[model samples]
Target: MGEKDKAYVEIYDTTLRDGTQAEDVNLSVEDKIQVALKLDELGIDYIEGGWPGSNPKDVQFFREIRNYHLGWAKIAAFGSTHMAKYRAEEDPNLRALIEAQTPVITIFGKTWDVHVRDALRITLERNLELIRDSLAYLRPHAERLFYDAEHFFDGFKANSDYALATLKKAIEGGADCLVLCDTNGGTLPQEIAEIIKEVRSRLGKDISLGIHAHNDSDTAVANSLMAVSVGARHVQGTINGFGERCGNANLCSIIPGLVLKMGFKCKAGEPERLRRLTEVSRFVFEIANLPHNKYLPYVGRSAFAHKGGVHVSAVSRNPETYEHIRPELVGNSQRILISDLAGKSNVLYKARQFGISLSAEDPVVKEIVVRLKERENEGYQYEAAEASFELLMRRIVEGRKETFGFFDLISFRVLDVKRLEDERSLVEATVRLKVRGEEEHTAAVGNGPVNALDNAVRKALLAFYPELADMELEDYKVRVLAGEPGTAAKVRVLIQSKDGEDRWGTVGVSHDIIEASWQALVDAIIYKLLKSRRKRLEAA
Candidate 1:
């Protein structure tokens, strides 16, 4: 599309400000600054840093951010309108906005008549003056001024004339753009489009427009897109939909929809960096110490995973038959899961992923498929435990290349002890193993049986392989198999391990939790050793 023909929309990211309101999300000053740099690199138009007066951490963020140079995104400080009793210039919140020294200023004001009367305990006319004076006071301090009309859609529904009046005052006060906010997030897409159209008509075509939506109804992304369709030029959202309750619109989904689907132009929506959306999404979650939702649209683990027999076959033949867009476009790849419902294509795809040279016609492909189906039937899930699947494929394709004879397990034992005088109990474990031609023995006590076993096993190997000290189990999960023995059912164990620079997963299944944990633990150590050996060889 030509530059003139392409629809241009401003991409404003509120992940740092609004996203922190999520129940478990809290970013330190350093974390917020680091995220801002990443967003700047991704070409986001505006980065809403935080409410400076709300907390000391936000104040420090603005101070620290001034020391660095952002390439593309202009930093915006977010706050509300002036207080009811104070002048715009005298209000601490407005003064903090100036103190932040950001090029962009975003302030929200009451657009709903109910908020004016009930929340502020002020008359409707006074609320209009607050919106006007707040924007006018900050307009000279910022290169760009944005006004968020809080509850614009809901207010328009209840009192259309009053909502229109607030937008006019903001325009009269010199707001560069007026953003309609669906704060309650209850408005439908059709309602949003119509309201924005009425706004455009009443406000005239010369005024700039934007949309800010929440995801309570699971339609924030859709509502933002619908508003854009009706001549709204700017879109506001948080990464991964992080926000107060449900969330704000997800910029990860909204940006792609605008640029790739709607033929719009966003600097951050450039095709190359846009492909990094998945990486950017996960990075935010990591900084916030939050678990990523693997089911999110376009960037999730399950977004492109193909599982069923017919679906895998069709996806292999033509991905478009079942897939929406190419997974590579958003930094995700096609994943063919190995399960009871899998077929030859799943096995072949997995082999290719591990760099194993195999073809559909290879008889070993059929063998691998059968073996995977059998293991899956025995309550092994290789989807989340990809390291185990890779090991299984390598053993079948390369004939036990991973078994490097690092060490051989002899036996292990666990003991649980309790004292009648105290309420606490203790567990201890001992492990015996052989390295080359000698036997080594070690024992350790821990809070639980599994913890003691981990310590004991690592104790035995740390002498010969000091690198083993760097490897620790990051997570462990177990699931009980149905249709097995009722209370004494078979269980599957998934172990996630991490070294200094890398993480991997391994799995095991058995009726005994201890045995199952041992199996997975052994596989994890073996994989780490094999990886270390491969890296040395490649360097040589």
Candidate 2:
């Protein structure tokens, strides 16, 4: 069907504004611009750039984004209603919104009497004036003017008359759309449906309505969908639910829900654009330097992963037996996890993924399954550390044991010294390894024993393998196993490493923290070297 023929819903992404409000999510101006372009490519209707009045970085973002032309997405500048003390034209916040020069300007105002009295410390009638005047003053400057009735749901519940009055004020000021915000994210789906129905009734069906929901109650996506089910045409959310406290509604889940299940079409819901969902989700996470939530619906890695022997057997036969939607629909792929619960079918699946030609009847496949179970029993989780699992399989396949042909660890020592006069400890490490029958020795100093060891090992190997210079340790995580033992408990280290092109994870477990780190680090280095070797051979 043509896009014009479908029932359309507008997708307003607040990722740049609301998503950055997430703890530990800080995007530079360049990052924001890049993310804006990505959202444009994904076909979002509006991209809330940021609150230009709030900070210099956001203001700078507004100035910088002007240079780039978006495909179809409109840039939006967000701010609250003008302060009660000042006229709309005199208010610096409103002036900043005008200065932003965005085609769309979204201004939020107090919707509840309690906020007017308690938060704004103004008379309810005066708060209405602020809402009306703010939008009226800016209405002419904005191609599309939107009024976000902040805390609209809570306001409606507290005093239905006051909340409806706020909408009326926004309409008086010429708001193109009245966005009902579940600011606290406490409303349920049924409540959303009922409230929106009441709103449509009072405001008349001709008014344009939008839903901006938060996920504090973990129902943002549900509430958004319900609002749509009841006639809201605009949805406001962040990708992957990134927002303050809990999160905003996740556009990642909401878009697919509207397109596939709810039969509503959006620019992002087009089949071709929908396929970029996973990539955009990961890109935002990457730009923020946050780990991806693999459990996120539709766009997460584990979303379509089948692990259990029975489940894998069933999914291999018919994906619909387990999956709700095809993983490819959101640009995610089916992952077969290798664990103690894995059977030969899991092994065969993984073997094919790794480009290994192993038949179901191969004795080696059973050997790999048994060996994987044994390793997992020792606190080695291959699911997050696929490089280690691949190495294990390759070792077994090549009839070798323990280590690969790239290099072997001979011995390593770390010394940490602290003096009363010195504020911090100094750590040094010496590493000796055998590479292609020759022994290489190196020593290095670092902030910690693990870092010192990493430096020393790389220092020793760099002379022989210059490609190792391109590899960097992206993240390192340590999990204490058997915590009852406390200080003496075994620890599992998962090391994430990346070179110029790809990233891989490796794992190791040991009673000693440094030893576990070393094991994972070694696996990471070996994986990189092996990948480089494979690429070189393929080119030849």
lDDT of 2 by residue, 50-148 (tens): 998999998999999998889999999999999888999999999999999999999999998888998889999999999999999999999999999
Per-candidate TM-score against the hidden true structure: 0.67, 0.68
RMSD (Cα, Å) for all candidates, in order, is 6.7, 6.4
Candidate 2 clashes between residue pairs 3 or more apart in a chain or in different chains:
none
Q: How much is the lDDT of residue 435 in candidate 1?
A: 78
Least lDDT summed over 10 consecutive residues: which range in candidate 1? 339-348
Query: What lDDT does model 1 reach?
Result: 0.86
Could you tell me which residue pairs clash in candidate 1? none
lDDT of 1 at 44: 94
Best by TM-score: 2
Which tens-of-lDDT digit does each residue in 466-522 have in candidate 1?
888889887676767776667689888878788887677788889999998887888
| Number of the predicted model whose lDDT against the real structure is largest | 2
